[model samples]
Target: MPAKIVVIANQKGGCGKTTIAMQVGGTLGRAGNRVLIVDADPQGTATRWAASAADESSFPAHVAGLAAAGGKVHREIKKYLDSYDYILVDCPPAVDSPVPQSALLIADVALVPIIPSPADLWAATGTRGLIERAGDINTALQARMVVNMLQSNTSMSKEVLEVLEDFGIPLTLAKLHLRTAYRQAAVFGGTVHDLGREAAKAVQEVEALAHEILSLFKNN
Candidate 1:
């Protein structure tokens, strides 16, 4: 079967797109799936994250850079569809970028990560529109909004959550909280699961996200 392609995109930067792509891809890989992370962002943050891993215990998933492919990314990714069980594309953070639209053309799902802030919410409108447009052509393409760096206690977060209910794209049940372990994982070039006991909560969050994402393809 062809791999389930998940394009992680948001027009605004600093929304944790790479973090979500890597963490979710890594968790799925550890769960015995052949996962591949296509780093479509010119920033190459995903490539660097895998490169930073230690030789003894490298990142669970394979990371490939396809930023140069630009609008041809969907064509490029098609070549690997049969080789892996999952392909997660981390798109560049730009509203004008062709990468997100290209990837979404062949994607099984598009996950838009948004920070729980007024600015982030406002910026996400562009992405929501992009997804909506893509869905018109790619009828099988599903979309979900993932709340990242969520500070549940803050009034801003609460308001953002309420607003997201009508944001067009459905929200994911699993949310990632503001935690130091996520940063540590990036530094160490691994998922939160590698952080051991101190990152228990973080591990659960990523795992839950992976589970929810995988469930979307269960009937396929």
Candidate 2:
């Protein structure tokens, strides 16, 4: 099967892109698929979290690595890509960058994480333009938007839902609600599974995402 490459991206910083990538990768790995995580954030937050998990629980299924930059990044990606079943690239925060461009160029599936705000939607236009410029993407690639860190009971939440609908982006029904467990789980070097309750629910959500991703590979 052709490897499914997904870049968890957003032009804005602090949108939980890294967290989403790591958690999704972790969930997939736990579900028995060989998962490879590329920490493209130069800051290496995802790499650090993977390291913490390895040090604490000795997570056996995850293969997390630091991503290279410049034109060489794509070369490095191509070199070791086939060894895993799935590749999750944690793209940099900036919208304009060679790394994100390279990632989008090769990505079979791109996931943009939106924080459910109008300002965030406005910032997404640049990323959308980048995707638009890369034609024939539907043949070799695809893209979707997922709402993260949602607080569904607020008025802003309703507005955000309307915007996601009007904006014509596919919103994932499962939400990573703004909960203390999300923060606590990350610091402890684990995911919602370790924290329990809503965190576990969050893990289930991501696991469902993993299943959807696996289906994409099957249909291909």
Candidate 3:
């Protein structure tokens, strides 16, 4: 079976794209799925996170240079698609960047992680456009966005939640709470699943994401 490809992307910075990628991949890996992470960004954030021993048996991820691939990254990803149960790509901040666009080219699902706010919502418009453009190449691409770092009490968060509900994107029903555990765990090279109490909320959120992604691959 071909592995489901998930590209976590956002053109704007600070939207937690890499964070969501690592967390989602980590969750899937720890759940006994064969997982491969492709660090498409020049920064190699996911590659470093996997290489660090502090994260789950020190998994070393594949790092492919977009410039070197010259539109061949999709073929490369397809070659590895059957080797794992999941192939999650951690894309750069620039949605138009070749690496990210290539990620979309090969992706089965595009998970766009964004903060809950009007500004972030506005940024998603550009992301949607980029994904649509990439869709012209990869017709199998499916896109979904999740709200992250949400503060329950904030008016912005509430307003954004309603707005997104009205906007009708496949929004994750479970949200990631703003917590120090996520930050602390990442610094140690692990994910929310490692934290005991501080991770209670995140665990559910990631689990929900996994369930949602899993639904995409289900066949009648």
Q: What are the clashing pairs of model 2?
A: none
lDDT tens digits by residue: candidate 1, 133-196: 9999999998999999999999989998999999899999999999999999999999999999
Candidate 2 structure quality by residue, lDDT tens digits, 10-92: 78898788877877777777777777778787778877776777374454345455455644565666665778878888888
Candidate achieving higher TM-score, 1 or 2: 1
Tens digit of lDDT per residue, candidate 3, span 88-177? 877778655776777687788888887998899998888888788888888877778888889989887988888888664578776777
lDDT of 1 at 218: 76
RMSD of each: 1.0, 2.2, 2.5
Highest TM-score: give the candidate number.
1
Stretches of candidate 1 off by over 4 Å are none
Candidate 1, lDDT over the whole model: 0.94
The predicted structure with the larger lDDT, 2 or 3, is 3
Q: Which pairs clash in the backbone of model 1?
A: none
Error of 2 at 53 (Å): 1.9
Steric clashes per prediction: 0, 0, 0
Give lDDT per model, in order.
0.94, 0.72, 0.75
TM for every model, in the order presented, reads 0.98, 0.89, 0.88
